[model samples]
Target chain A: MTIDDGPASDRVRLRRGANNGVYERQAVLDVLDAGLIAHVGVATDDGPIVIPMAYGRSDDSLYLHGSVANAALRAADGTDVCVTVTVIDGLIIGRSPFHNSMQYRSVVVRGRARRLQDDAERVDALRRVSNHVVATWDQARPPTADELRRTMVIAVPLLEMSAKVRTGGPVDEPEDLDGRHWGGSVPITSTFGDAVPSPDLRPGVGVPSSVAALDGTAVHGLTTRP
Target chain B: MTIDDGPASDRVRLRRGANNGVYERQAVLDVLDAGLIAHVGVATDDGPIVIPMAYGRSDDSLYLHGSVANAALRAADGTDVCVTVTVIDGLIIGRSPFHNSMQYRSVVVRGRARRLQDDAERVDALRRVSNHVVATWDQARPPTADELRRTMVIAVPLLEMSAKVRTGGPVDEPEDLDGRHWGGSVPITSTFGDAVPSPDLRPGVGVPSSVAALDGTAVHGLTTRP
Candidate 1:
C-alpha cells in the first residue's frame, strides 16, 4: 500500500497524504468493490465530460457500459480514460478552517479502454456490471439478443490504476493550535434501506430471497457485517 | 418547468420524464443548493478535462475558486464552461436488469465563466462560497489580503441553465410484467450527523449556535423532515 509502489506514471501519483495513502493492488480493488457508481471522465471533441456510470470489477479489469450510440462510450474505445470512484466516508473538520478536508477512499484508474467486441465477453461484462448493483441480477433474467446488441460494453485493464486515500483528523498549522473553533469530523455512512416494492407490482409474486435477505447497507458491505 | 421554457439549446431538452421533470428557477436553485461539488468541464489542448471543485450559489450565479497559478482557473476565465452537479437519490432497480436506473437530480449550467476582476466582488464571491459550505464560516475568519491574492474566483451567471431530474419507481416495460423477477428500489439518503468536537479544542469554548443549529439536508426537504 505504499506510495512508492503505486502507478509508475506521474499522473497517478498521490499529491496529498502520501504517508497514509494506499496504492496496492488489493487496496484499489477493495475501494472499487465497495463502490456502485463510478464518475467516468472521457475526453471528448468538445471537452471532458464526466458521466455517472455503473461499473463492475472482474479480477483486475474494470467494465463500463452505455447505449451503443453514446458518443462518450464510442470515443472512449481505444483511448485513455480517467475513471474515478470516490467513497466519501466523512468530513474532516479540523481545528483550523484551513485544515478542513474530506476522509475519502478514491481510486483513479487511467488506462486505454477498448470496446469488448466478442459477444461472449460482452455478455459476461454486462452480467458482471449487472451483478455489481444487485447480486442476483445475473440470474434474474438474461438479456435478449436484441438487448445485448443495443448495449455497448468497454473494458479497461487495471494495469496503471492507483488508489489515493486520506483518513483521520485534520493537520492544522502550528499557529492555529490554540484556536477556539469547534471542529473534528462529521462522519458519513451510506446504507441501503429495505426494498420498497413497486406500486404496480403483479399479484402473488413474493419478494426474491436475495432482495429480502439484503440488510440496510451496501451489498458489498455484507462481507464486513458482523 | 417544461423543456420549452428552459434553454433554447437542443442539448438542454429533456428526452426522458418530460412530463414530471422540473426546470423552474426554484428547482434549479434547489438542485444547486443541495450539492457541494460541481464538475467543471474545461477544454484543454489535448482534450476536455473535468475536475471536481467546491461551488457556491448566490442569487442567480455560481462561484468556483482555485489557486491563482492553477491551469484550470486560468483556462476557465472568460471561457464557456459546463458546470454540472448531480446527486443520486437511489438505485431504481427494476425486474429487467436493463431497466435499472439511478434516481438522480442534476443541474447543468452552460456559459462563459468570467473571472472577478474587482477585489470586492472576489471577496464577496468567496464569502458566498464559504457560506454555502458552512453558513457561519464567512464571519468566523475573513480572508486576509494575502489569502485573497493567492486565490482566484470565477463567477458564472445561471442564465442558460437546465435542471434534469428522474424520481419515483422504475419505468419497466410492460412485456416484463409477468416475468418472475424481483423489482423495487434501494433508497439512499444523505444527512449530517452529530458534530464531533475537535480533539485540540480549547476548554470553555462552546460550539457556536449557528454551527450547532445547522441541519445539513436538502433545503427542499427542510419542511419534509420526519
Candidate 2:
C-alpha cells in the first residue's frame, strides 16, 4: 500500500481527467471526513459486490460495522476491499447533452479490510462510526456488552487512496458557446429537514444539541460547517 | 446470471437483513431509474476499485458512458463489474446509539460489462445516459459522429440484481424505549436549486422545460416524484 505524500500506484492512479484526482493527504482526508456513508466493494466467487454502509474515520483507518450475520462483513473479513464515498455537489448542465456532467467530490480507498476480533477494538470502532452520524455519543446510551458482541467492525487503513473532485460550471464546446442553449450548474444541497421528535421520548427531551446542529449543514464534508 | 423473475444468486443475496432485499423486477427497476449517479466497482490487479459515474437504464440493461481514455471504462470493459445506486431517505435517530441507522433505498447490479463498439448501439446508449440527467435530449444537440467515436459505453445487464430498502422509524429495544434519549427521523431531501444559466447562453434562451421540471424532484427513487 502506498502511504501518504507520494504518487498513487497504477491501480489507484487516475488515467483520465487526472486533474480532478487529489493526492495530498490533507485533501483526501477532507473528503473522507465529510462523508457519512461509503460504498464498499469486495470480490466474491460469483463476482464483485458493492453496497452502501456507514463508516467512521479514526486517524488513518476507516471503520465499518454491522451485525455478525452481515454478508458483506463475512465476505470482506481479512480480504481486500474498495471503499468509495461520493458527494454530489451539483448537476452540470451543458449546452450540449454530450458534455453534461455532475459536480461531485469522491474519495476512493483501496486496501485489505480486517475484521476486528479484539473486544476493545470493536467497541472503539463502533463508537467512531456512530459518532460520525450523531456526533453526541456521550449523551446517547453506549452499546451494551451484548450489543457489542453481536456487532462486527472492520477497518481499512488509508493506504492506497485518491480524491476526485469536479466543481464550477459546465465547459461547453467552442462552437456551442454561441448556440441557443442554456448551460450552467444546478447546485444540490443536502440538509436536514424539520426534525420529527420520537413519539416514545420522555417529556422535555427536545432535540439534542448534537442532532440539532445538523440543521442546514452540508450532508458531506466537515469543512462546509461554519 | 440470475434472471429477473428468479431468486438472486447467493453472491447478490442479502444475509444481514434479509427482509430488506427486494427481488421483484419492478421494484428493483424503480430504484435503478431514480438516480443519475451510480458507484461502479470492478476488480483490478491490485484490488477492487469503485467510482461514482453517470448511468442510464434501458429495458434490462444499465448503460455507463465515458471517454475512451477513462481508466474505469477501460478496466470495466469486457469484465465483471458491480454497479450500486443508493438513495438516502432519512437519518434514523434511535433511543440508543446502537440502534441508530439510516433509511435508504439501494439497488446492486452485478454482471459483466461489455463496451459497445457498434456505432448505432453506442449512440443510443449515450442518449439514454444523457436523457436520464436532463430528460429532454431532443432539444439538446445530439452527439456528432466524432463525439461518438471518442466515447465508450458499457452495458451491464440487470440479470443479477437486488434492491434493499429500509424505511420508517428505528425499532429500539424494549429496555431502551424508556431511556431518556431524543429519537426520530431527520428527513433528507435532495432538490435542484435555482438554475444558474450559462454566461454564454444566447438571449431569450431561458431554462428549458425539462430542466425546470427537476426543480423539486427527489434525487433518487421514481415513486417519490409526483
Candidate 3:
C-alpha cells in the first residue's frame, strides 16, 4: 500500500493506513462536502466523547457549531480533536467471511480547535456552515445579535487532515478461492428525492429551483466514479 | 415534550434531541440493518478508541469480529461498550444558525459483549456476519476450523439500547420564521444500484438473483412504515 505524504500544515502526521490514512485530498474533500453531520471525537476528563454536530468547510478550515454551554466545545477548544466524516458507498461481499469490507470515503481531521471570539469572524463562520448544507442560504437570513450570542461556534484548521477511501471488490485471500461462497459486491448510492412542502407553508408557495433541482441527482454529488 | 412512557426497550432517548424522536423497535432495527459499517466505541486503558468493524445482527444480538490478537476485541469482551450506527438522511436548513440540524437515524447500544467460545456457535456467528452483506451466503459455504481459529467474534446482547431519529424540515424558533431567510430541507435517500460482477470472476458466471433483486431498494430493507 502506497502512503501519500500530508501537506506542510499537517500537525498530526497521519500514518496513512495505520494511525492516520489519507488516500487523496480530493477524495477527502468530496466526503466532507457530501456530509452534513460529523462525529467530533474529543478527549474529555472523563473519557472520549463522540458528539454529532453540524459542520461546514471553507477550503481547508472546518467549522462546527454547538450550544454555548456544550461540554464538547469546551473540551475541544485549544486541544487536539479528531473530527471524522464517513460516507458509505456500498457493502463488499466477498466469497469468504474474512474478505467482507465496506466501500466508504472517510476524512479524519486532527487539529487544535480554537473558539471563535470575534463577532465578525463568528458570523462569517456561521454563514459558511449554513451555506454548506444549502447554497445561498446564508444570504437568505443572517443571524441577529442575540441569536449569535446564544450559539457557540468552533473552528478547527484542517492542518493534518487526511482522507482514506476503500472502493471496488472485496480482496479475498487466494486460499479461499474454491470455497464456493456467494461472494460479490453491492453498490450503494444516495440521492435526493422530491421536495416535500412543509405542512404549515402558505398555499401556492413554489419550491425554490435550488431545492427542486436536487431530484434525480446525488444530494452532494459525492460518489465513487467508475 | 412527552417523555415516552413506553418500556425501556421501546423508548428512543437521545441526550441531544429529547423531543421529536421515535423509539419504535422496527424503526430501530431498520436503521441498524441499513448500515454496513458500525463504529465500535470501547473504553481502553489508555483512552476511548472508536474502531470501524463489520457487524452482523441476529435477533437482539449484534455480532462483531476482529483479529484474535487485536486489543479492541480484548477490551470489548466482558465490558460495557457503546456501539453507534448513524445514517444521514438529509440536511436541515434553518432560517437561523441555532435551528440547523441534520436529519438522521442513529442507534446507540450500551451493553456487555461476550466472546463466543463454542465452535458451533462461533461458526453460526460467522455465517450470520457473512449473510449480513449478502443474503443466502450462510448456506453457500462452511468455514474451515483454521479459519475460525484465526477470527475472534464477540456478541453484544441488545438489552439496553435506544434509537434516535430526526426527519422533516428545520424547527426554527418562532421569531426567526419571518426573518427573511430561506428555510427548508434537503432530503436524502439511499438506494442500491444494479449489481456489478467482479472483474476477476470466471467467464460466463451468472449473477445471483438475490443480488440482482436488490436494485432500487434499500440494501438491508431498513425502511418501515409506522
Give me the candidate number with maximum lDDT: 2
After aligning candidate 1 to the native by TM-score, how far in Å is the CA of B158 from where it should be? Answer: 2.5
> Candidate 1: how close is chain B to the reference, as a TM-score?
0.88
- Which residue pairs in model 1 clash with each other? A48-B48
Model 3 spans > 4 angstroms off? A6-27, A43-48, A69-80, A175-182, A203-206, A223-226, B1-13, B22-27, B43-48, B69-80, B112-115, B175-181, B220-226
Candidate 1: residue B96 Cα off by (Å): 1.5
Which candidate do you rate higher for TM-score, 2 or 3? 2
List TM-scores of chain B, every candidate: 0.88, 0.92, 0.86
Error of 2 at A95 (Å): 1.9
Better of 2 and 3 by DockQ: 2
Q: Which stretches of candidate 2 lie over 4 Å from their true place?
A: A1-6, A202-204, A224-226, B1-6, B224-226
List per-prediction Cα lDDT, in the order shown. Answer: 0.69, 0.80, 0.68
Best prediction by TM-score: 2
What's the lDDT for candidate 2? 0.80
User: How well is each residue in A1-226 modelled by candidate 3, as lDDT tens digits?
Assistant: 2356654443333442343355456656777887656777666554455666778877768999877877768888988777777777777766665666677767767677899999988888887777675554534456678788878889988666666667788766675555444556777887777766555444555566666766778754643221
**lDDT, candidate 2, A68-159, per-residue tens:** 88887789988899999988988988887778888888888888899898998887787788787667666677778888888889999887
Better of 1 and 3 by DockQ: 1
Clashing pairs in 2: A34-A221
lDDT of 1 by residue, B1-226 (tens): 3543555465444444456456677777788887656777766553444555668877878999877876766888877777877777777777877777777777777677899979998877876766665565642545557768878899988886777777777777787777777677777766655566667766776766645655464322331111
lDDT of 1 at B197: 67
